[model samples]
Target: MAKKKTNEPKTLKPEIAVGVLGSGSFATAIVKMLVENSKTVHWCVRNEFVKGAIELRHHNPTYLTSVSFAPKSIKVTTDINELVSQCEIIVLATPSIYLSDQMEKMTCEYRDKIFVSAIKGIVPKANDVVAHYLRDNFEIGFRNQAVIAGPCHAEEVAMERLSYLTIATVEDEVSEKLCQLFSSSFIKVEPSKDILGNEYSAILKNIYAIGAGIAGGLGYGDNFTAVFVSNAIREMEIFLEAIYEAPRDVNESAYLGDLLVTAYSLFSRNRNLGNLIGKGYTVKSAIQSMNMIAEGYYAADSIYRTSKEKGMKTPIIDTIYGILYEEKNAEKQFKKLTAKLT
Candidate 1:
């Protein structure tokens, strides 16, 4: 696998078929971005209802409504086998909870094709990152694929906001290929070898985002938030030290940048759910109102569970799980979390 030079412009093939494994906002946004950039994409939607919705409306009305696609521009399917057979590059955009089930049914003929994982959480049952799941299940080598993590918001792409993502892989060829595949006028791609570190940082930020939102919901001032986010970074670093080689700029665009944005941004359902919890809504109520899967909600369980099994300290993740799932008081949990941080 050859390493590609960063920021060096290279020609891209005009006709590339990208397969998207989920019909969620992230998947829709990525596929739509490719088409808007004139790249062909195939997407899999499991239910007949969603397939019909996309065909009739030209958009995934349930997940991402602001962006629409032409019926002929993107191939939308209910059949997983068909999607796998046709795609050159497969993007697993499904949420972490559903990832295992989706992978179980998928049989890829293109073992040599690039597998681009846009999923951002640890798989709960296996406690595995997306890349590891692909490798163990698909028997693909490091050079066969890449993972994209970032501060990117799928909603922003609906407004065509310029965003950046970090592509990390041990194999230089996979990283470079992913960088080229996802790069467009609106999407900027940077490559790194710190795949594990990047994934951990990306996952931890969600837990912290819930904390920030709780603070916001409680009417806490910026002074509190600044300290909170700083400790959040420290906690992330402490965890990553054991699991990864330490990535450059985890506090920058891909890691901390994502944390800041997701923790406070209007587009974050995780933050929103935290806000509701802080405001005294039950987890069930918040989830019902949001009508979405906040990966952070699920990640709290995975994070806390994995940390417990690994003998790692994760007060932030535990605090979040307590509030969202255990029905703990948000203010008390915030206090406990802050005390631990200090």
Candidate 2:
């Protein structure tokens, strides 16, 4: 018995079929991007109504409604197996919390398919990132796995605003092909082999965005935010080095740029979640109010537990976990955080 060589490139034709799994704003945006390059995309919409709306109305009824699609270009279905069987490449855009259940619904094989994770949070109960979850549970190899990370937001993508995306995979050809598939006049695609670093950075940035939003909601001005973000990146660098130790640039768009956008952008759901909490809403209440999933809310506990077990001192992560999970006062937790930041 021999182990499979995961890096051996599989033949990806120029006319490869693509599928997007999820019906959220980001998923809608990704479908939009794919249609620009590929002829038809197999889309799995879990909600029958949303699937109907997309197929019949040519737009997502709930998210990114402004961006219309050609009905002929999208093959919309509620069945995950239907979509998986129809496509060679699958982009997972589901909320991390729902991912395991969604993956469980697939009865088809995934070993031959190329999976790109657009998810930025850890899987809740499993405490694994999407890439590892695919490997551990589905036996999908690293070469078959890729990640789509943003400094880019869905709203901006819908508006056709110029944005940057980093496509990361251990296999160079996989990363390059994805980059080619996803790039457009308004979208710039960069390639990287640092899949772990990029994915971890994507997850961590959302948690830090919550910290920024809390500061904003608490009436802290630009001066405090500037210092807070600066400290956040340093904290991110230390944590990544301690865990993965990859020779990667922390200042790249996939790292620092993603952090900046999530922390400061108006479209950030994680920041919005923190704002509600900072304005004195209970965690349960704030979560109930939003229609979207805030990755930071889930990532906080997962990162905290993992960091503690690994014996990494993450004061910012600790402060956020206390404020969110331990029921600590936001003002006091942030006050303590201020002392540790400089």
Query: Please, what is the whole-model Cα lDDT of each candidate in the order they appear?
Result: 0.78, 0.89
Location of the lowest summed lDDT over 10 successive residues in candidate 2: 6-15
72-115: candidate 2 lDDT, tens digit per residue: 88999988888888888899998899889889888987678899
**Model 1 Cα lDDT, one tens digit per residue, 228-318:** 8888887787677756656476576778888888876889877887788778778788778887787787778777776777677767777
Error of 2 at 121 (Å): 0.9
RMSD of each: 4.5, 6.5
- Indicate which candidate wins on lDDT: 2
RMSD of 1: 4.5
TM-scores for all predictions: 0.89, 0.95
In model 2, where do residues sit more than 4 Å from their true spots? 1-13
